[model samples]
Target: MDLDCFKAYDIRGKVPEQLNPELAERIGRSYVEVTGARKVIVGYDIRLSSPEIAAALSEGLRTAGANVFDIGQCGTEQVYFATSHFGMDGGIMVTASHNPKDYNGMKMVGPDARPISSTNGLLAIREGCREPLGNARQPGELFQIDAMKPYIEHLLGYIDIDTLTPLNIVVNPGNGGAGEVIDALEPYLPFEFHRVHHTPDGNFPNGVPNPLLPENRTPTSMAVTASNAAMGIAWDGDFDRCFFFDEKGRFIEGYYIVGLLADQFLRKTGGGKVIHDPRLTWNTRELVQEAGGEPIESKTGHAFIKERMRDEDAIYGGEMSAHHYFRDFAYCDSGMIPWLLVAERLCQSGVSLSSLIDARIETFPASGEINRTVKDPEHILQGIERRYLEEALSVTHTDGLSMEFQRWRFNLRMSNTEPVIRLNVESRGDIELMKSFTRSLLDDIEELDGQSLRDPQLSVAL
Candidate 1:
């Protein structure tokens, strides 16, 4: 088995070649050993490889002298739900999330839905798999359970759709696992659903079901405009990330949604702390403050943000990457919660999604995030700090490298899971200045790294 399958957040790799049933079984046995859990729950997505992986993993878990309860074909969130709902010792989800169809991965959760990343215990699990557990095989009973209905009820209890007014909306499930949940909730919703590719198709004929890419969003945007809907929403493979589009079929930045959701949560929770990533908008901070809640900033990624939320006892957290974590949901990020809040807000206020987000658009102008590849990522980051951040602003190396100014801020960090460096720039409502400064910084870094734009393909990919 390839060791590269163990990633920063979870175990992921190309299916068949890098990831297969044999490897998944090893991981399952390794997880049971490292966590020392007697019983483990398992869940999977709609991907074709998921069921096989789940079965193999269960076999491995049973071999390790542990009981396995299999919740067949569910979303990643459902796996988290089962860990806490069924009172299991630990759980594992068979999914690659938003990655392409050729890839597959596993996400592990400890008791109470606590995540296990590489730095936590993933490496130990990997190393434990190296030595085989001979003659330790034990057969455990397998049973099926429907975790979806209870999970849906739990979500609806938190969001009140009855207070919403009637509106037309389009939901593009992108052929992932969200279709069933959306279908189950439609009858209770106060809106018209113009759904596209809502069926769960693991083949992903509509191009991987990732709404972040412009190409993947074309279908959702077109449906929104054609149906004359108030807005459009799309989800990733496992439905962990949700992206939005306006009435005119324009994609809204995820940063703004963060502010919108934070505002709503603060209103209901009576000014609890809200957490946000440093990438996109400071408007989230301003909104939290205005709502009488403390705002906390953290490094990007679900693991980092979730850890901070737990420490601060935050009510809500959002990242520009479209991951939203809620206090009610075990402090784990969910793609389903943000849209539910948006729908409820639209219903109660009698406002369109576009109109609700307009005020935030004017307040927080961002250049979005840009990624570039370089040989020496650290050297380029150091050069950026020396040239742009040394004299005028405060700099911190929390996740990557972040520099703050009075009116403008930017974060330049290397990817923990990949070789590329990511740059995120934001300013106080000045679009042009943000663009100009971003280009200048990119040019400076390229010159220092002695690299040039070798691939026009990168531009097309973004």
Candidate 2:
């Protein structure tokens, strides 16, 4: 009866107490009722509870007269791929991506693999799940599907394979689902892979799979340097987001990767719209324009970016959080496609990954993302906005409070699920200025809140 598992974008919470097989079944039946999806694609991640949860969910869908195409033990994007690729009416991926191992949840998408968030049918499904179940209709058929082959082929379509020469790359899945995908694609590529924590382990023996954490990056970074690899990549649990490291074992901030990917996508498409988050913009905007593509800014989050990409028919969309969305992949984010394209660029340009990113870093320096747990996020945000409103050359609220001055800019936003404030600062060809503004902003925030701030953690080095 406890349906607290439903969240703004997806269902995520502790197992059993917050989410269980019984509740999952109800959700499955409710999904069919709310969206009227006749045929649905179902998949799950590497969590231990995933298989049972997925099976119960399929039973509910079948009882509701919806045929279920089950893609077993896959990442979230695989469900997205299968749904849209097979022309299914909807899709559901059982995953608590990057969450603690004790938790399990689901991400759902409607027809064409469009996300179903609170604004759409998520709320309705939650409400429907609370009511008593009706008599079962004629049960629909269930079919096992192997979606990996076509999905892998679709990923290969992103770049010219013949252009890719042999190179060494380090891939750390962090004991998540990405290793399986890399294994599936290994034979088709020319690169030699040095894998770290490459198995699919639900226990997450090497800590949780989030590569965003500073500590989690050490293994991948060390391997890249020790093996003399050209580049390194890491993905979170369920592999929805991926992070990169250059030849020098230096972590490349996701902000820079957005710009790099935009440039690559634009070059291939000749010219198309590229959607980017507003948190860090100068680098992406400049590269997009130079590549003869329009740079469209969207509010942060996968749902908003995907919706914007659909509206604009964008060739690609990227968030500095490492979620890269491709127009061809049902506008869903993929951990696999990004590294492949980056590798292809490496081969074609004959330049190191660091070389490709260094110029961009110098042109537009950023503070990356700094997270601070504030006593009052709204008060802090409003106070900062009031102080900066006068001197600001421009202010935008695409996602949060973004103010631009003559030479530098900063964005301050509150976290959706916590009382944490995220800050990002950037300057036009000035790293020192960016650093200075970042320090000043933190000082201002603490002074306004009248509380000593916690030691802020930077998601990436300046």
Q: Candidate 1, clashing residue pairs?
A: 164-347, 165-347
Q: What is the lDDT of residue 54 in candidate 1?
A: 91
The candidate maximizing TM-score is: 2
Residues 1-462 of candidate 2 have per-residue lDDT tens digits of: 788899999999899889998998899899999999989999999999999999999988988889999999999999999999999999999999999999999999999999999999999999999988664558889999999999999999998999999999999999999999999899999989999999999999999999999999999999999999999999999998999999999999999999999999999999999999989998899999999999999999999999999999999999999999999999999999999999999999999999999998998999989999887787787778878899999999888899999999999999999989999999999899999989999998878666324322221110
How do the residues 23-129 of candidate 1 rate in per-residue lDDT, one tens digit apiece? Answer: 88888788878998877889999898999989999988888877888888878888888888889998899999988898899999898888999878988999987
**Cα deviation of 192, candidate 1, in Å:** 1.6
Give lDDT per model, in order. 0.84, 0.93
Taking all chains together, the TM-score of candidate 1 against the true structure is: 0.94
